[model samples]
Target: MIVVTTPTGQIGSQLVHRLLDQDKEVRVIVRDASRLEDTVRERVETVEGSHDEPGVLDEALPGAEALFWLVPPSRQAPSVREYYLGFARVGAAAVARHGVGHVVGVSSAGHGWPTPAGVLSAAFAMDAELGASGAAYRALSMPFYMENLLGQLDAIRGPGAFHLTCAGDLPLASIATRDIAGVAADLLTDLSWTGQRNLPVFGPDRLTPDGMAEVISQELGRPVTYRRMSMDDYASLLRSRGAGDQQVKDMTEAFAAQDHGIYDADWATAEPTSTDFRTWCREVLRPAADA
Candidate 1:
């Protein structure tokens, strides 16, 4: 059996379907089993509880060959590091206890950077804790997600623009979540690969926010632009949207790290993954913008 966490999320949902397509025996730990589609619910074994809960993974991990792990975002946590490490520690203990053979985890790019990177730092800590578990591990180290633009669908549709704290003219590496799912599915299914390593998943194009806007305009057939917001203004916006103070602060630090090139190390050396920005914009964003 293979176990998946956050099975209803964008990446997890896609990963689950891909695993099913391969005829893999799958089980998922989810908060609400009802949120899964009727067809999906009928197919997989369901462990209905948060993965971080005391006994949830204990119930799900036994006899599983491999596990796909993702820490769901939590905005209410007091400290970002503690919040992420809490989940990782639980997952590590479960993996060690059950003797699961392989584990694949969702993580960010800045694993060994010298500076403190807030949420990115938290993810690095997660990788460390999980690596200590006896299971063979693969940490999918990802850069910026292109799907993050979906959060600004309203801005793109209404004012024909998107906003971010990064420099509009500086190119940054990014990947579609679907591609990340594809990579994870491949790793989880093929348990032959052993030991711990970071797999950098990046899209073919390194596009600036302005360049992205140009592609979005071409795909959507509307004039869209990129607007750079100050870090202070970004924090204010997050706070206005009801994000906790520490969450806002951590996010701000993450963006600051990005601005300082936290993703540059892996991006410079890694082979590009399957999806490109233009294709993602045409296939994913265009449809969302139209809707």
Candidate 2:
């Protein structure tokens, strides 16, 4: 049996369907089953409640071979660091108790970089918590998601511009959550690997906020521009949108870290994913815009 956490999230929900397609016995830990698709609800075993709770995981991990874990964000979290580590510590103990062997988790790039900011730091800390356990782990390391742009579609429609905290011209590594989930599903089903590692799920090409605006203009056939906001200004903007103090701090620091240097080295991998910026803007963003 394979267990999934945050099963209703953007990545986990898709991963659940992919695993079902492969004929694996799938179980999910979720807060609300109703958020799941009608088809998904009928197929998988549901353990209702938060996955980070010890009681919930104790029940979910027994007889399970592999696990897909993700720590869902909460604006109301008291401490982002403690929140990430707290879930990891609980899950690690449960993994040991239940004898689950393999773990494929969601994380980001820059694992070894110094003083990683915000979610970047918390993600690395979470990986360490999972690694301390006996299970073999693979952290699916990602960069900025392409889907982040969808949140700004309204701003683009209204003012012909969208904002980011990073510099307009500096290249930003990015990947689509679909590609991350696709590779993760392949790994979870096999369960043949042992030992811990990181998969750099960077997409086909690196593009800056300005470069992305160019692609959006070309794809949507409308003039759009990139608006670079300072870290303080961005934090203020997030607070205005209802983000709490911890969330504002985490997000602002994460963006500042990216502007400095998101990844430590160049990724010269062979045959990276083909879902380039233009393709995403054309396929995903265009449909969202029309809606």
- Model 2 segments more than 4 A misplaced: 242-246, 266-271
Q: Kindly report the root-mean-square deviation of model 1 from the true structure over all alpha carbons.
A: 0.9
Total backbone clashes of candidate 2, pairs 3 or more residues apart or in separate chains = 0
Model 2: lDDT of residue 147: 92
Q: What are the models' TM-scores?
A: 0.98, 0.95
Count of clashes in candidate 1? 0
Error at 120, model 1, angstroms: 0.7
* TM-score of candidate 2 on Cα atoms, chains taken together: 0.95
The TM-score measured for candidate 1 stands at 0.98
Candidate 1 structure quality by residue, lDDT tens digits, 149-184: 999999999999999889999998899999999999
lDDT of 2 by residue, 1-291 (tens): 999999888899889989999888999999988988889889999999997899999889999999999999877786688899999999999998999999998998877877648888899899999997999999988888999988899988778898888888988788888888898998998888999987778888778889999999998889999989888888787889888888887877787777777663524442367688889888899899889
